[model samples]
Target: MRAFFWAAWLGLCSTPLLAAPPQGFSFAQKDWELACDNTGACRAAGYGVRRGEVSVLLTRNAGSEQHLTATVTFAQIEHDIPADSTASLLIDDRDFGALDALDESHFRLDSDQTTALLQALTNQRKIEFTLNGQHLPLSSAGSREVLGKMDAFQRRTGTADALLDKGDAGDDAILPATPAPEIIAAPVLHNAQPVPLSMLQRQKLLPILTPLLNQRCDDWQNQAIPAADRQITLTALDKTHSLAQALCWRAPYNDGYALWLVDNAQLSKPRLLTTEASSYADGAIVFLHKERGMADCITGETRVWDGKTFTPSLKYSTGMCREITPGGTWMLPTFVSQVIPRQQKEADNLALRTLYNAVLKAQKSDPELSLNKVAEQFPLTGHITDFTLTYADDTLITTSKPSPDISDDEWQAFLRSSISADSENGKVSFTLIDLDGDGKRDLIIDSYVGGTGLFSYTGVLKRGDDDFAAVNGSDSDNGDDFDAGVPGALFSINGRGANQWNHWVKINGQVYALWYNGQFGEDNLYLLRPFSTTSQTPAVTVRYRYTLNSIRSPEKDQPLTPSLSDGDKADLLRSLEVMQGSLLKDRPASDNDAPICPIPPGTSADEADNYYSGVAVNYIYETVAYIPVWLNGKCYIGTIFSHHGAYRHGVDAEITLSSPREDEEVIGDYLISGLRHVIAITSGWKTREGDNGMQ
Candidate 1:
């Protein structure tokens, strides 16, 4: 049984200084002296003579200011400074021009000197300037004083330096972290008993017992039942009954039970149902009479003795059936039409027998297709485990303690490929599918090859006559005997159709090509060059021209639209064309190294690549393409290729985008917020793991 509840509340405050910070320049510094307002604003002041003794200053303002001002002074010294040697300042990576030079030794910024000057600069608890990749010292007393003040402000308000120094001082800092509460299992009930009572007897004794039951048990919601019902089920027991047992099973439903005897003749009313009593069917069962003059008949299932004197017929039996409607407990075929058919059990048996026979035949025919073979191939060996079969028709058939010979590798692999596997006992199961796409189904055999691997094989039978045979009764191309010279070669005649045969030759470490048809000679054979580098070829190319054009051209000039000129189109096509063949001609063949089998012509490699390459290149490319656009910068793209994981984890090169700035609109769509920290963003929340632990 479960219960539920709810709660609610509200408030306000009064502090003018507690408002959000103003926007603009708020802080700065100079060669030896620094000046700033109480509103968290400052700047840097410096004079350079290498380029006409120009003076530079940095500042920030916080209020509702829209523009920033910079003032500069030039020393009265004639230098080789270029006429176009203009002064500039950067605000959050955005470059802005300084005011025109006042003279050879002085210049003034166009915006406000106080707020704007301070707003443009970032406040560091300790500012360390660098010259030409080398650190510079702020050893002056004024510089030290400014740095001290910034640190004091940061410590007092507990706000970020960037926010406070930018004149946006009043912005609330991040909330303090809190730990999450742990989840515990709900309490369980213990020991319970069932009591029986009759309908007429219960009604006569209800008033006296009702008060006692209410005080002892929690609130009880009565189950739905008709007034004429003879039985009622109690859900929970009182404290007295609960303390008496560890666990007790009540009626499947909530129906109260019947009492064996009632002393109704001695009292004016019958006793009420006890709070310690348990029910079977809630209030589902009710009694009915056979005839108008007959006594009431028992509706619920219970062993009862008939009022007959010591005879075989003195026993009563009852069976359960679905009720036709509310208050209408009639048992008939019309009321329970949705039932299992009589012949279903027999049909199911026949199907299982047929399946069993198929498996037996497969085991007999294939020498390498058994649990023992799987164990021999892989490293798994353990006790016989349980197995189960789930039919497509929603039926779960299970078997326990089957003979164990399947390897652990094969069993684990089988589970990885299929949805069902016993994680605890290391069992492997097979699922049959129509691999050939014929209307008739075929079987897929899967098992644990070893403790660490899984093996699968499609059930296909090869006809002997279909073997490829060499023409002219000679296996050798030259005068050499085929078997004597070509030790690792095999030929077979394709009997399925005309002009169909294949030859397998191990020439090098890689299985080169599987050639078919009579293209080469009368004997159609697959050329398997194991160690020959010439046997392999490049499938695609990455042309520098394509890469450059993709970046230089505008979006309207993309090839996916109305197409392009012959020259442009040819360049794009040439980008994907293979240009060179293997340079190795006399290399020796190695054992077992082979290229992936190629799909038949006319099919695309898209699906195959996607399945084998865990990283989705398209998704990566899209993310990269949008980076610059989001940063409000010119579109720039580059590619990166890296190995991701083992087996089906290789990733190919693709475009990447980069930019600088906090362009909310663009950044929000492409990059996740927490990941921004890694992407060069200065402000971002750390990801938390397992309660309050930062990830």
Candidate 2:
């Protein structure tokens, strides 16, 4: 890949730098190579203890639209570590909870976390990532300079990504104010409603019509009839009644026509329910098919048409979601009965739910399941790593890294005597983790027996005064009942290996069981918040659903911080203007002053400000790539507070900038309604690393 990238760069350099800047730039910073591509894509990549192995990578996307990412990649592992397992990062002895895992080797921090990490990487003398039982030290040598170079490259590419404070000069973001509530998306409704033909014809409905047209035939490649003769019908579908009436035979866009619907009472001018690929029912469920790679990503909305207005349902879907409602029918593996049968993979939630439930049951029933077994079957599948053992203070006791001195017999003895006294006829696998938030390290053990059933004994070994003891749980001892592990289907199949239950997750002040529904790469987090009780029968909220992007949606948006007074808002905005000076160009201001923090689509900046007040709200990494539609062929720099369009008004999209305002010039908060005005796209406010020197 390096050879190919270099070759591409060498070829691009033949051109002049007049129309565009230099195609590429490469320089060495600290022990890292800071490289930038023609489009301003830059990366500060370096190694840890081992060379040639990527350990830390900081990327700043300075293209048309800006995106910044930070990654810490771990070394190789021999055993499987659950991706959901908690891995702690110690920056000069202070513990920052497990970094978000992009994979077992690579972990990506969020914008806030990345900001904190960049600071630590630049200032702290020591940094260590503790996963399973392994203690991986990351050298901070030259990291500060590397980050500086990263900022320089970003500026050259027009990103100006991060304004990292000099040395430990700014306030610590280690515990920045509790983050603001994520803007939760409205509940998305997919059920389609029928509407009258008159409404559809008068409104020129396409959102409803396209699907029915698609259902009528496969594609428009071989339509036999022309526009005039095609039969167009309209259906009135409601909870109470449903009927269809034939409409005039006409098809727009030179295509055939089909039955369609429109919400006549939903909007000011009878909005086209079918026009936006929306499912009409109460109001309209609008969606768009965003193509990401070969997979089709669905982002959409659920809005209810009240008598007067179209209200957002606040439930929506974001990220790359497969049409689990299969387009065509096929056979799928089934665990409904003891005998494995092939069932039709129908296009409905029932089939998918049934399959998931079966997998869960099988995981519960499979006693001999082992993490090692699953690892062998599905290599590189989960956030998996080698088994690790650490001391009480998270110091490394032993790891799965192969030693040069140990023979096979000696290694076997080491495995047996590491933590447990005896294997007791099962494979010995253990990890150092902290279940009850004490400073001491706890043990997670999987003592496996033979058979694809519940022969495996797995549970936590809470640290005691002398050694570790079995946790006071029903499945602590060799028992029939225990969550065999996540991905129960795999557990049922490989019962004789290891248990891959993930580590615990603490939200607010409570710890809960966290797991993933889908396989690796495709992530769907299930945060099961457990209600504390002494009784063995547990009560949990069952699940909290989200993809990484949808973590902060409108419905889920909460004020994780205190509210700021108008005075505080005014003062902070003034201070922030100083930082925006670095990114703003010399341009005339419009007659109207930019609103303090305008929240478009009916919400004001003040409402949003109150909604997301305090230090947390001020530091939101909401940057956007906006084209300054210049008046008379000139560009002006300003901030873009919030965008309200795509998939029902700024639903699950992200907008973050590195340096929004600098030099006493604030980026105007103009909600650009049309695209014709935009000329150059760049970052807005809510800059990265440190928010206007406020950390």
Candidate 3:
């Protein structure tokens, strides 16, 4: 690519003059061209080029402390112009009313009393200027000279010293020195080795030469040459030639000797197309065809002679052939085996059906064994080329290309193995016996190896006493001697026989051992004993059930009376006082670590003031033991001292015990009514005492 450069002149102005009338300033062309402003605080200078587009602007502060400004006279190349351009500054935030533009190739911003000018010049691409009235020339030649001088100075003083000095000398102006030219070495090109034509070898040999024979034959029809020349050509075409000679000498073959092609251009050794046996067999009729001037095709007879008479048994045809044995004899039947229609057809159908059944059974049995068994039983024999099996209801049918015979054993083995349970831990086992005492035998199976353990299924058959016997048990250790300890046990119960039961022995233990029993309503387990103790009865444990009401009384008991002695009474009263003070009204408290009386603020002297009052009556009887009783339901138990006098007077004598008060009704409804009254009495006494100064 291309390289581009950009430069911008931003103007910032001090507060505009607002005093007396300001003097005007003008800029001469020479001053504009030579002067450069370094402060960067210069007023806006218009007449800068931007991609060959130009603009002029006048700036004035609009209002406010931020010094908002508006453009008064703005002129610039329209947006999207396809050239270098310059913008004329109209409104800058700091300047109140100013005009800025480029004049004489210099940036100039003019105001009433202040005129700022930037003496800068630019070529077609970029502008170059120096700060503080320092002029910088604007030519490639000037840049090269400056660079050369600077480079020479750097060589004289070293780069570090030159950079430190930077062509700056006090009281004297300094300019950058020019740089020296640089030289680059030319690139070298190497001669590459010629690439071998290996990729084109096959294409040139095979594709090109095969068609050349016919093309050359057609070329013979061209009669433009003289008759003598044609005869010479015909004579030359009748000679014996090798591929190498044909390409080198361009000669055709003779009818006597076999033609051999050779590719001498390739590094490989030359090859012969016709062996001596082939030459003898075909009587020298061999030809080598090569395309694109390379050897490819070799044509000769297959039979070879053993230095004697030529063999004539070689044959060539495009069809499939298979050798029956290692002696290289093709498998082709010379005689067909005769078949009786009825028997052969029946056997074929049976074989096909067996295969179909085997495949269908594989879906439910061990898939691998099912498939192999099918192949073993109904093997593809005779002239079968393809076969298919399908299902119809519970039966399986098969269609064969050319069906064959299947023996009875093969069919039976296929059915048996297909439905047989898979071996467990390399062993096949199952058990049957009555396990639930429901008369029907339960079947237990162990189909997989490594102790698939045992699984039991209840049988549908029933026996006497509604008992069900386990019909099968395998690899099970269910804690019963006859049923549990038996491994691969298959039992059958004879309801009519004298022995009544017969089971196959699978485990190594005694055959008469009772692994489990269905005699009881459920499975009865028995531990295995030695043969000597097999006749002894086994120990057993029984379980029972009960209900909750039989363990506790049903009715609630009456509360206990106050039975404290004089000393205990005093202690109790003091304790009650402390409890009342701490107990707050409407706020319940736990009896565990209950607050002492002398009730806190926001509390009451009623039952509501006592926290432990609402606890269960039985719980209170267990914890406190005191109860308040009423004689006539009014002012009797827990009565205030003033009410105590009325209780001592005629009211106590006349009141009957049968009457109940409204507050008594409320207290009776709660489970802890007795404790609630005691707490209320204590709290009431404290309230009265606090009022009487006894508190």
| Worst ten in a row by lDDT for model 1 | 1-10
TM-score of each: 0.15, 0.25, 0.10
Error of 2 at 308 (Å): 61
Q: For model 3, give the 10-residue run with minimal summed lDDT.
A: 685-694
lDDT (CA) per prediction: 0.25, 0.34, 0.23
**Residue runs of model 2 more than 4 Å from their true location after superposition:** 1-22, 50-54, 63-67, 77-86, 156-161, 165-695
Q: Which candidate is the best by TM-score?
A: 2
**lDDT winner:** 2
- Report lDDT (Cα) of residue 357, candidate 3: 49
Error of 1 at 434 (Å): 36
lDDT of 3: 0.23
The sequence of per-residue lDDT tens digits that candidate 2 reaches over residues 1-695 is: 11112111221111111233324455555555565544344556555544322256665544222344565644332233555655656677777766765334446556665566667776765666676646767666666676666565444312233545433322221111111111222222336434334654545544544455455444322345553233344444443222222222223322222222334354222323333332344334333343343222233344443333334432212211222111100111000001000111111123224323433443354432222222122122212223523343322345454544333543444444334422234235554544445555555555443333334434455555555544332211011122333110011222212112333444333333433221111112222222111111111111111121121212235531222345533443343334323221222433223323332466544544322211121222233222221222222332333211111212222312111222223222212121111112111111112111101
Ten contiguous residues minimizing lDDT sum, candidate 2: 332-341
